[model samples]
Target: MEQPAASGPPNVAVRAAEKRGYAVSKEQPERPGRPTLDAGRSGGVTVVGDPPRRPHARQRISTTLDLIRANPTGRIALKIFIAIAGALVVTIGIALIPLPGPGWLLVIAGLGIWAVEFHWARRLLGFTRRHVHGWTQWVTRQSLPVRLVLGAVGLVFVATVVWLSLKYSLGIDVVAEVMHYLATH
Candidate 1:
């Protein structure tokens, strides 16, 4: 009798093996207790995550310069107006320093407006950045009782000024006379 063919068609062999409850095995064993890989991580290579990004100081300065350069005449004129208006507001705010309306905020805004165009203003801004946080921290470190007392005093001062302004602007002279007396005597 002729011996069975040692080599047969691959599909036939596969079918025969499957009929016998046998199956082809992969090269490596699948590991347990690990996250499954998806299409983005199909390859065997491991990828490190990227570091966080931060804007550099020079980049900020260059962007500011680019903004200034973009508009030749219009921006310059606008900056001039901002400087003038900011100065006027700051001057009036300073006059009201002993009264109310956030004098320091107006001054800071004035400097900020100038800072858009001037190097000196930029330096001042940098100076304020360095110290303002520390100053605020110091103010907060004061005793709670002291803070309450100071806050009450500031509120009273603000209320007095608002009352005087409303009274005088409405052509009422009594509050103005009282202020004049307080200033002189």
Candidate 2:
């Protein structure tokens, strides 16, 4: 007997299974070549979804790199330009590091900018990507309290560094200014 179709949000794999006259079950083990969300879930937890289909930036970068690589005569000039641009980006990133912004990301991006033309940069970028991915996974696996405490500690460290920098550079504490304003007002 044909059972009533499962009523819920549409899923690609479930639809496909229904089309093929196969019963769809939430607890059904994933079969090869099937896009099963249940396969990705463990103990009611999902690790990651599908990756992006296409990255525009990646396409642009590859196109630019291919153009540079094809022109053997202009290779040296291109390399020089790439190096200068990457160095400038890295310098700017370093300057922004203590200013509460995407400093490290910019630095990694600069390395990526260089990676297109430099083998060493490519290796370094891959290494950084791997380590960062592992670190992210490890952090995600930590208990909430542990994660919160680590975050608090990091915040305190950055605050302390910022305070010291402001005190040394401008001879005034921002906290003191805020306090003075509060007391006078």
Candidate 3:
């Protein structure tokens, strides 16, 4: 004689169990309706299934930090580590921002790094996301000619910034060089 399994969706059961904080058990019940050993948040209710499946990557990383924070010394160390790493990323992003080549990408990445550990950064990231999304939506909705004009304006802006940066920061006068080349030819 053998006991039959409980009848319900396994995924739902697992999710409910995990949300209420119980380790999942794959084994079939010794007796139907009998609770697992680590079954309940309190005597008021029971979670009769397994824990959540592997968490998302973000959750996994957060759990690692949670584990580290169990110790007071480890908590301090983690904060210091996050601060230094985030600052380094932001600094590099700032340095590269004037010259292009994934400069904005790096700066956003740096902001993301800081957002993980700081509330201010998290809010700022949200604001940035919203504004960028709005801009993209606005651009996509415009007429072809309007969009083309906008693109031309953007190109001109980039060219001006690049020319100025090279000339002023590196002493490389691109317009003069181009003129000299044209004259020689």
Candidate 4:
């Protein structure tokens, strides 16, 4: 019976040990109370745990606002161009909001464009965010019936505007004439 070679290369022995359910440590010393190879499980790999999550909304908003505010005296043409581009981005973003593509992100960009030109935009953005935040909290507290009624009221208001526009701008006479013709033949 020939004795097996003790070692050829370090990787060969380490791989063999790993296959047989053992870990080959790097140069670092193992921590006390930490299990080595066989005491835990068959795999040689170890998973390091996730870091703790931290809140970052304030940091992000401040950084973004600062970048926008930095160009206060930038060119008018550039500002207009940026606003148009941002509006297009926001339009596309709004369409994608219900599906994907980060609609809120485009809205922020649109606000940033307006913020570059107008104090009202800044105030409006602040008001919108505050109201939105409050409304979200309020909605969670409200009953379903209250939400449904509010939604219906909003829909009716929109429908009334549409109805009035069609009646006045497009003329009720044309509508009636079309209806009369349709009914006749």
TM-scores for every candidate against the unseen true structure: 0.43, 0.61, 0.70, 0.38
Please, what are the lDDT tens digits per residue for candidate 4 over residues 1-185?
23322222245544655575544442323433333344264454433344423325654444334333434442455567767876787787776554334776778768766775667778978888898899989977899999999889977775665556667666755557778999999
Those runs of model 1 whose alpha carbons end farther than 4 Å from true positions after fitting are 1-64, 70-107, 123-134, 172-185
Q: Of the candidates shown, which would achieve the greatest lDDT relative to the real structure?
A: 3
TM-score of 1: 0.43
Residue 75 CA displacement from its true place in model 1, Å = 7.7
lDDT of 1 by residue, 1-185 (tens): 23222221234544554565555221223333323333374453333244423335664454444444445564577678867886887787676665556877877777877777778988998899779988778779999998899899979887877677667666666666888999999
Q: Which ten residues in a row have the lowest lDDT in candidate 2?
A: 1-10
Ranking by lDDT: 3, 2, 1, 4
Looking at model 1, the pairs that clash are: none
For model 2, the stretches where C-alpha displacement exceeds 4 angstroms are 1-64, 178-185
Q: Candidate 1: lDDT of 140?
A: 100
What does candidate 2 score on TM? 0.61
Q: Could you tell me which residue pairs clash in candidate 2?
A: none
Better of 1 and 3 by TM-score: 3
Model 3: residues with Cα > 4 Å off, grouped in runs: 1-53
Residue 182's C-alpha lDDT in candidate 2? 100
lDDT of 2 by residue, 64-174 (tens): 454444455546888999899999999999877776678888999999889978999999999999999999999999999999999999899888878877887778798
